[model samples]
Every structure is written in C-alpha cells, then in structure tokens.
Target: MDKIKIRGLEIWAKHGVFPEENVLGQKFVISADLYTNTRSAGKSDDLTQSIHYGEVCQFMKTFMEEHTYQLIETVAEKLAEELLLVFEHLQGIRLEIAKPWAPVGLPLDTVSVEISRFWHRAYLALGSNLGDKEAYLRQGIQGLQDRKDCRVTAVSSFLRTAPYGGVAQDDFLNACLELDTLLTPEELLDVMHEIEQEAGRERLIHWGPRTLDLDIIFYDDIVYDTPELHIPHIDMQNRDFVLNPLAELCPAYRHPLLKKTVEELKNALTEPEEAHAK
Candidate 1:
C-alpha cells in the first residue's frame, strides 16, 4: 500500500472539558497518513488516479472547525471515519490530533491522540428454513447493506438444501456474501443478531428451524472464537450448503485454519459420498 503523508497541519478549534476552552478556542495540530493505491497515479501522472493531499487537508481543517467535542480522541475518531467515507480512493488512515494548549498545570509540550482505522473484508453465510425462506435471506442481506459501515460486495445464488444438525426440518434456503466493513467482528455479530431478530428468528430449537440464520464464516483471514461467536464458523468445511455458496463468490479463498481453498473443501466433502454410490 502507498501512503500520502500530511504533517503538522494546524487548526483552531473548540474542544475540551473546560468551559473556558470551548468559549475561547485553542490551537490544535493534525497529521495523517492516508493509505491508497498510487501506482496508477504515478504511472500516468494523473491526479485523478490518486487521493489529493491538498483536498484532504482542506477537508480535515473544515471538519475540525465545524465540530465541537470535549476530547481530541473523539475528534480523531470521527475525522478518520469521515475521511475514509468521503474519499473513495482512501483505503485506511493513521491519524494524530495534538492538543498543545493543555490546561494541566505541568509544563508538558502537548497531548495527542493517535489511532489507525481501515476497512475489513468479511464473508457471511445466510440461511433460512422457515416461511418465505428466500425473502428472509434477501432481507438479511439488505439489512447489512443498509448500514453505512458495511457494504455487500457480492452474493451467491440461493440454494435449497436439507436441514442439518440431525433435527428433522424443512429444507433451507442458503447463500453466502462478501462484505466490506469498518465494524469489528463483535460489532458485526451484533448487527447480524439484530437483523435476525427483525426477521423473527427464535432460539427455541437448536437447528430445528429458523426464519433467518446469519453466521460469520470469515473475517480478514483471522481466527476468532468466543462464547457468542466463532469465525470460520464451526464445521463449515463439512457443510456443502456453506461451501457451495461461498465458492460461488470466492472459490480460491483459503481457510485460515484448514489451509484449503473453498473448492478443495467442497470437493473433499463430496468425493466420498460419490465414491459410495459407485
């Protein structure tokens, strides 16, 4: 990734815990390292192929002056999100906000808040066995797309498959999707659960039946597990319903743990069944 650095840009803004600081305002310094692909811009010598540092500086200056917050931490967080949203070419940002006029009695030079934020790739599996199965799955996808922090990049054709978990139930409509999001894994899970609730999902039966079931199959090739959620979703390699739809979107995507592509896993799971029928 290439970077466009802007350092020591100063601005006057009202942001502090003390009332006087808000009333009188103070000087603050801002710096940022914008991440993007500058290869095209460099090769063609075209500004349109890259993010404009001057435009970014102006946007940052105006944003800081327009908003009033009690802490520089809030300022940095909000500013980074806005920059990433407004600038289509920007992939990530490392931002620092320095407050030179600290009210502390000490002779410290300054106080600053620095942080890094970026977009993350996540894959999700969608399933529904109850009424209007396809509709429920579509609604779930729409729910994720509706969030500003999440974007649905690709989706697979929904397939009807027999229910798993050894619980006799109707066939389920299953599919997979690729997501580009700024939300953390936990935050994304919360959003999925909210969408499920909106679709009238219930936990009354374990895999017995559901209106909507959204599971996080992968997130940036990272392994994660918790009491409430699991990444790479438990036993996903064994479930064709998951692999089939996922392979449609990303056949070459490898499992972080198993170290096999989706196509490999799908074939490995089905080959034995085919052999038995021979």
Candidate 2:
C-alpha cells in the first residue's frame, strides 16, 4: 500500500547477446519501486519495521554484476525474483534494467526492459481418497513448500467427506491451504500436476477417484477462467467440502464471482441439510 522508490542507480554488468558484449561489460541503469506497508516503521521510527532501501540497492548492484544473461529482459526478470526473495518485507516490485551502451551504429541513447512482479495470495483446495490419503495430502503440501517460488502460509484442519461425483470410492480427506507465490496461474497448475503425478494420481476418469486432487480455489480475489483452468473453482459455492475448509482458514475470504464470503457459503450449504434432519 506504501511506496519506496529507488531511481536511476547505475551499475556495470556483463550481459548481452553478443560474445564481445559478454566479454566487455556495459553500463546498466537500474530502478525499482518497492511496495509495502511503511506505517509502522514511520510511526515507530524503527528501521526494523520497514524495508531498508540502501541495502536493497547494494543487493541489486551485486546481483546484476554477478549474474550473466543474454537479454535485458532476462536480467529484469531474474533480478525482480531475486529482490523479492531477498527482501521479505517487499510485497511487490517494479524493476527496470536499462542498457545505455548500444551496439547499433545509429544514434541511440539506451534501451531498457521493465517488469512488474509480486507475491500473489492463492487458496488451494486439496483432497485425497485413495490409500494413505492423509499421506498424499501432506506430501502435496510439502511439494508446494519445497518450491522457491511458493510459500505455504496457512492450512485448515482436514475434514472427512463422502466422495463427490457419484464415484464409489473411500472417504476423502479434504482441506484448504493459503499460499504466497511468485508463479503465474498456469505455472502453479503445472506444479500441482507434478505433485499429483508424484502421488500416482491418474486422470483416466473424470471427477473419479484419485490419490490426490489439488485445485486453485482463489487467487487474490481474481476472476479467471480458461479452457484448462477456472478461478473460484467452478461451483465451489455448492461444495461443502471446499467451503468448510476454506472457512476454517479464511472465513472472510470472499468469492469474487459468487460475491459471498466463505463462511456465508458454508452456512448456506449446510443450513438446508440441518433443517432436513430436524
């Protein structure tokens, strides 16, 4: 919500497509806008409460000088990742890498590449219905945690639920997890698929029994849908298994499409069953 700007910091780094450019370094002007909450730091007058811009500058300089890349785009991309990783206080960053020395024979001052990268909050629904279902679910969480680009922030207590989709299978262990990740939606899906494969999950049957099932329930209140994936997880409001776990971890987390909080959805789904039993 607050901004700390670092502009026009110059550095010399070896990064270019040409062989000679790699051998001979060039001047690169780096700029970054670090985003975070600085209110506590400002009020307390404590350096520990906020990000240190001076340290960030030194880190940028050292990182650029150490790594060699073929394109300024690569430099910006990799540098953004590095900065976000190094500074735990930084939630997002806008980075620019400018190459002033152009090999072009024409008159040109410089060329640059800029990128905006941030840690995205994502909610994941995890389920398993095969042998050692709890083990599969735990393994899936560990796999996500192992990735450098992903951080598991919170986890809901696991719930036992009857299988959905009319599949004749064992009871499922279901839960929701909160994560902070730098990966894009598709990239995160790929990671989930990898975990599923590791758990020996098969996709032969649609909505059928599986060793593990991981679905992206939410990504920063974003409404996204593609042929391969859908955000708000298509009819999640109707599934008690999904909502119950979500309510445990984040009852206030609202569904962007449904416009209902997790607690509301969970209550709406359960109230009718409760009345029926009464």
Candidate 2 whole-model C-alpha lDDT, 0 to 1: 0.92
lDDT of 1 at 97: 97
Please report how far candidate 2 places residue 6 from its true position, in Å. 0.5
- Highest TM-score, which number? 2
Task: Work out how many backbone clashes candidate 2 has.
Answer: 0
lDDT of 2 at 131: 93
Please give the CA lDDT of all the candidate structures. Answer: 0.94, 0.92
Candidate 1 lDDT over 68-87, as tens digits, reads 99988999999999998889
The residue pairs in collision within model 2 are none
Candidate 2 lDDT tens digits, 143-171: 99999999999999999999898878789
